[model samples]
Target chain A: DTAVSQTPKYLVTQMGNDKSIKCEQNLGHDTMYWYKQDSKKFLKIMFSYNNKELIINETVPNRFSPKSPDKAHLNLHINSLELGDSAVYFCASSKTGWSSEKLFFGSGTQLSVL
Target chain B: AQSVTQLDSHVSVSEGTPVLLRCNYSSSYSPSLFWYVQHPNKGLQLLLKYTSAATLVKGINGFEAEFKKSETSFHLTKPSAHMSDAAEYFCVVSVGTGTASKLTFGTGTRLQVTL
Candidate 1:
C-alpha cells in the first residue's frame, strides 16, 4: 500500500484560479508536512501539521493555506494562484515530531499555473 | 538554523565504477542527517540516515554514508554504479529543538549513470 498519497498528481490552472491538493498518509504517523520543489530543484518546507494541529507554518504567502481534516489527512488550498506558484508539491509523514524518524514522502503533485 | 550543502549539482559515473556524492551540513545542535534519492517522475526515497547511532550508515541498493563531525560532512558512497541508479539525491538535516521536526534540504545532486 502507498504509505503517503496525494491526489491530482498533475494540476493545471489559469491565473487567479483556486485549486486544492489532497494528501493522506496511512502510516499512523503523528506528523505530516508539505514541501515545495521549484524548477531549480530546491526543496523547501511550506507547512507541517501534528495530530491535526498546525505546528510549523513557514513564510508562505497568505494565499496558500493548509487544512487538516484529521490526523490522517492534510490538504492544501491555494487562492488566487499566480504563475510563480508552478512547482512540484510533496506530502510527507513521519512517526514523530523529531528528526530521528525518517520521513516518508508521497509521489508528489505537480502544479502548473498559467 | 540548519542547512545542508550538496557540493556537486551533478555527478556522472559509469557502470561498475565507484559512486560518490559529497554533502556537508551545519547545525547549532546535534543534527540528524539523511540522504534521499528521487528517480525521475517519482517521489523521494530514503536512502540512509544518521541519528547519532552510528557514524557509518548502510542503506538500500548497496548505498552507504559516513558521518564525520570533525569534517562536518556526510557523503554517500556506493561500491558499484548501476544504470538504474541514475536519479537525483538530496542531503537533508534536521534539528530537534523545534516543536515539529522540519527538514532542511540541499539543492539536490543529479546522478547520471552510464554504460
Candidate 2:
C-alpha cells in the first residue's frame, strides 16, 4: 500500500487563480507535513499538523492555507497563486513520539503558475 | 538552531566504484540525523538514520553511513555505485522529539552514476 499519497501530480494554472492539493497517508501516523521544493531542489517545511491540530507554520505567504480534515488527511489550498508559487510540493507523514525522524513522503505535486 | 550542510553539490562515480557523499550538521540538543534520496520527479526516500544508537548505520541498496559526533558529520557511503543510484541526496537533522520535531534539510547533493 502507498504510505503517503497526494493528488494532482501536476498542476498548471494562470496567475491569480486558486488551486488546492490533497494529501492522505495510510501509515497511521499522527504527524503530517507539507514541504515546498524550489527549482534548486531546496526543500523547506511550510506547515505541519499533528492529529488534525496545527503545530508548525513556517514563514509562508498568507495566500497559502493548510487544512487537515483528520489525522490521515491534510490538504493545501492556495489563493491568488503567483508565479513564485511554482514549485514541487510534498506531503509527508511520520510516527511521532518514539521516532519522528523517519518521514514517509508522497510523490509530490508539481505546480506551475504562468 | 539546527542546520545541515552537504559539502558537495554534486558527485559523479562510475559503476561499481565506491561512492561517498559528505554531510555535516549542527544542533543545540541531541540530534537525529538522516539521509534521504530523491529520484528525478520523485519524493524523498529514507536511506538511513542515526539517533544516538550505533555510530555506523546500514541502509538499503548497499548503502551505509558513519556518524562521527566529534566532527558533527554523518557521511553516506556505498561500496559500489549503480546507475539507478543517480539521484539527489539530502542530509537532514532533527533536534526536537515527538510532534515537536522539525527537520532541517541541506541544499542536497546530486549523485551521478555513470556506466
Candidate 3:
C-alpha cells in the first residue's frame, strides 16, 4: 500500500485565490510535516504536527495554516496565495516524534500561482 | 547547529562503473545521518541511515554507506551503476535533543548514468 499520499498533484490558480492541499499517511506514524521546495530546490520545513498537536511552526507567513484532523491526516490551507507561493509542497511522516530521523515523504503538490 | 554538504553537484558514470557520492556533516551532539534519493517528480526515498549503530550501512538497490566519525563523513558507494540509479541524492543531518528535531538537507547531488 502507499505509505504516504497527497492530493492535487498539480494546482494552478490566480493570485489572491485560496487553495488547500490534503495529505494522508497509512504508516501508523505520529509525527507529520509539511515542507516547501522552491524553484532552487531548497527544501524548508513549514510546519509539523505530532498526534494532532502543533509542535514546530517555522517562519512561514501567517496566511499559510496547517490543520491536522487526526494523526493520519494533515492538510495545508493557504489564503491569498501570491506568486511567491508557487512551489512544490511535500508531506512527510515519521514513526515516532522528532527523535526518529527517517521520514516517508509524499509525491508532492506543485502549486503555480499566476 | 547541524548541516550537511554534498561534495559533488553532478556526476556522470557509465553503466557497470563504480559510483561514489561524498557527503560531510557537522553537528553539535550525537547526530543521525541519512541518505535520501528523489527521482524526477517523485518523493524522497530513504537509501540508508546511521544512528550510532553499525558504521557500515546497507540499503536497497545494492547501495551502501560508510560512516567515519573521525573524518566526519558519510559517503555512499555502489559496486556498479545502473541507468535506474539516475536521480538526485540528498544528504541529511538531524540532532534530536527534544521532541521537535528538524532535518537539514544538503544542496543535493545529481547522478547521471550513461550507457
Reference-based TM-score, model 1:
0.98
Tens-place lDDT per residue, model 1, A1-114, is 999999989999999999999999999998999999999989999999999999999999999999999989999999999999999999999887787778999999999998
Among these predictions, the greatest DockQ belongs to 1
lDDT of each: 0.94, 0.93, 0.93
Among all candidates shown, the one with the greatest lDDT: 1
Q: What TM-score does chain A reach in every model?
A: 0.98, 0.96, 0.97
Give the per-residue lDDT digits (tens) of candidate 1, residues B1-115: 8898899999999999999999999999999999999999889999999999889999999999999999999999999999999999999998865557789999999999988
**Across residues B1-115, which tens digit of lDDT does each residue of candidate 2 receive?**
9999999999999999999999999988888899999999999999999988889999989999999989999999999999999999999998776577788999999999999
Judged by DockQ cut-offs, is candidate 3 incorrect, acceptable, medium or high? Answer: medium
**Pairs of colliding residues, candidate 1:** none
Best by TM-score: 1
Error of 3 at B90 (Å): 0.5
Candidate 3 structure quality by residue, lDDT tens digits, B12-40: 99999999999999998888999999999
The pairs that clash in candidate 2 are none
